[model samples]
Target: MTPRRAPAERQRDPERTKAKILEAAKAEFGAKGYAAARVSDIADRAGVNKQLISYYFGGKEGLYNELTASGYRNNSAITDPATPLAEVLRQFVFVGPSDRDAARLFVWENLEDSDVGFDAQREFMQRQVEYMRARQAAGDFPDDLDPGFLLLALISTASAPFAFARVARAATGLDPTSPEFTEAYAEQMTRLVKQLAK
Candidate 1:
């Protein structure tokens, strides 16, 4: 008698398939922004049928929402305002894998004005702002500086490696994702913010 396959062996690798779809969606969304990205395009890039995207994520909007949610969760996991500012900044800037595609997709979605993913993005940003304010009140940051400005400065420094890698390379002849660069930038920015707060 022929050996029977296990139930798990017969089942599709849902996690792998979902990861592929998400990777494809990240590229398409980053390239086209949410309003212009097409579900068919993501399906094609993932080498899966368009129906599978619908089955797994409902549609393009759902996929975008999932990606945004994942990005927010990743950022939240690393951020802790209670920590010393330099340590917090370092983790935010360089602790994660240097997944440029994922980072670019997140930033692109965040900057776009389209309503498809704005609610979740706005909520995430508001939470961050509130966190910064709380830290300021706790004497972790200076009260004289506006919380919004401090938030933007922190975001810019944390996101610079992703947002300005090309410019950084051309100007500094260094890989933005390199440990040396992240360390130097984190140190410099931390000092700058500390001085500014005085």
Candidate 2:
């Protein structure tokens, strides 16, 4: 007799399966919010068994925490201290992974009052503030501007285009998720930042 297979669903590579589950979870959570999203739905979307999700992530809460870490706000590799802040801002807005769906997930996470590790992002923002301060001290950026406000402006401007993509598309008859729209938006934002320089 031939050896029994472990079942077709269990044949996937572990990393790929984990990634698919996360992607599916993000979509479900984004659309339905955490309160209503179902693990079975995520499994259906991912083409995996629901048991795989629970096995890999310890269920929804653990999966959500992983997502919080994956979002743009928690990304530690995107920043380079040696790179100019303006360039960093541009990359973050345009070239970085377009995590617009994750922005929607953030909305759900916030409304549910889940401990999604907002502090991790705050720590990253604080680093940006320090970077801006250094630039201001060097007479490159505006010295009169508050670093906190500058950091806020940078992140908010970068995130808003994606966060409000549907609204923007509806309001302007343009697809905010499209590269053309995002590139133009980032250019405008970069120009606005440059205008603030001393």
lDDT of 1 by residue, 1-198 (tens): 999999999898989999999999988987778888889999999999999888999988888998878877777755565665656666676643366677677678667866877777788788888777776776766777787788888887678777778987887788887878877877777776666445
> Residue 52 error for model 2, in Å?
2.3
**Position 62, candidate 1: lDDT:** 88
Task: Please give, for residues 1-198, the per-residue lDDT of candidate 2 as tens digits.
Answer: 977776885576999999999899888988878879898999999999999988999987788777666774555556655666677788878643366567667666656765555665567667777777777776557767787887777776777665666777887677877888877877887787777773
Query: What is each predicted model's overall lDDT from 0 to 1?
Result: 0.78, 0.74
Residue pairs that clash (backbone atoms under 3 angstroms), model 1: none
On the 0 to 100 scale, the lDDT of residue 189 in model 1 is 71
The true-structure Cα RMSD of candidate 1 reads 2.8
